[model samples]
Target: MSIYVGNLSYQVTDEDLKQAFAEYGKVKSVQLPTDRETGRPRGFAFVEMETEEQETAAIEALDGAEWMGRDLKVNKAKPREERSPRGSWGGGGRSGGGRGDRRY
Candidate 1:
């Protein structure tokens, strides 16, 4: 089972997250989202556990709990929506025509 954790402090690290949830159960992985340009933590993360019991435990123990001066939000992660690949210009369009169809 996987969970989405949000409202994190910028200083929060994967180790901190793991330690917090470790008290409840085994954490399979912890992923903190980072800024695309600055590469700094985006103040949210995702945690995955091997069992529903573990997930439930972590959620019950951590949700709305304060950590690093911020309230942590824990809940089941939603499935990622499929996105189209980049540069997928499948639409029919034309551009940069030199004065065509114009009374130049």
Candidate 2:
């Protein structure tokens, strides 16, 4: 459903991405994330297709192909890892400061 596209031109828009993938299959969605402070294109995007076959076709055709003056790095998007709170540990097998329950 999701494909990660890297090394994209900042000038690219969501519609442009959709159109590019349209030849492979129906594009469900396209997301081009931007910088928090600048709101500019982040030079990468996540494209969603209607099916896995369409996704695989897009990956096979677009991966390493030259487009918009850069080679594309297209692949299946991996699920994001769960994140812990800013200062809290998620109990990933590490000692808590190694201080025997001592408090600062």
Candidate 3:
């Protein structure tokens, strides 16, 4: 299981996360997603450790701990929910009216 690290500073990087978690144990991987529009860090990350014991230790040590000027929210990541495809207007394409409805 991977750990969900939240309330991170925008400046945080993958290597930074790896280093922080490495103190507890071997860090398997770190994923920090970025905003699609502005192309900036999303202020959160997912850290995968080599073992559950190491993951637990990291979570206990880091949760609510102040780091990078923010209180961290570290826990096991929940399974990502499936989202429906979005349209140009950000809707789920449920609205029927569109360019096809206009007949000049």
Best by TM-score: 3
lDDT string for model 3 (1-104, tens) is 89999999999999999999999999999999999999899999999999999999999999999999999999999999987777645756656887788767
Between prediction 1 and prediction 2, the one with superior lDDT is: 2
Q: lDDT by residue for model 1 over 12-70, one digit each (tens)?
A: 89999899888888889999999999989998999998789999988998899988999
lDDT of each structure?
0.90, 0.94, 0.95
Candidate 2 off by > 4 Å: 87-104
Clashes of each: 0, 0, 0
Which is the better candidate, 1 or 3, if ranked by TM-score? 3
**Candidate 3: minimum summed lDDT over ten consecutive residues — where?**
86-95
TM value for model 2: 0.81
lDDT by residue for model 2 over 1-104, one digit each (tens)? 59999999989999899999999999999999998999999999999999999999999999999999999999999998998679875677867666587876
| Model 1 clashes, total count | 0
lDDT of 1: 0.90
Residue pairs clashing, model 3: none
